[model samples]
Target: MRNRLKSNEGQNRRKKRTSDVEPVFGHIKSNRNFKRFTHKGIKKAELEFGLHALAHNLRKKVS
Candidate 1:
């Protein structure tokens, strides 16, 4: 894994992956203080996360 990331192609891929995905998680965890799921079951957990993602998208769109 270290060697792969050391290559040029892997470097570009890692950069793209982090740029696209990491900020949203960082914002959700740090800014929103969302650390864990309050619900217990899988269905409820999915719904909760879906709602959070929806709200994030809506907020991003509005701003």
Candidate 2:
């Protein structure tokens, strides 16, 4: 894993990955205050997260 991260391709991928994903999670956790799922079952949790993702995308689109 360390060796992979040290390579050029891996470094580019890591940069792309963080840019693509980290901010959405940071916004969701910090701004939205979504710490944990309120639903219990796996399916319900997935549904709840799906809603959150949808809301995030919609907000991004609006802005």
For every candidate, C-alpha RMSD to the true structure in Å: 2.2, 1.6
- Show the lowest summed lDDT stretch of 10 residues, model 2: 21-30
For each candidate, how many residue pairs have backbone atoms clashing (under 3 Å)?
0, 0
For model 1, residues 1-55, the per-residue Cα lDDT tens digits are: 8999899999999899899989998898788889999999999999998998898
Off by over 4 Å in 2: 1-6
Q: Which pairs clash in model 2?
A: none
lDDT of candidate 2 over 1-63, digit per residue (tens) = 999999999999999989999999899989999999998999999999999999999998999
Candidate 1 yields a Cα-based lDDT of: 0.92
Error of 1 at 42 (Å): 2.0
Residue 25's lDDT within candidate 2 is 88
Query: What shift in Å separates residue 38 of candidate 1 from its native position after superposition?
Result: 0.3
Best candidate according to lDDT: 2
Candidate closest to the true structure, highest TM-score: 2
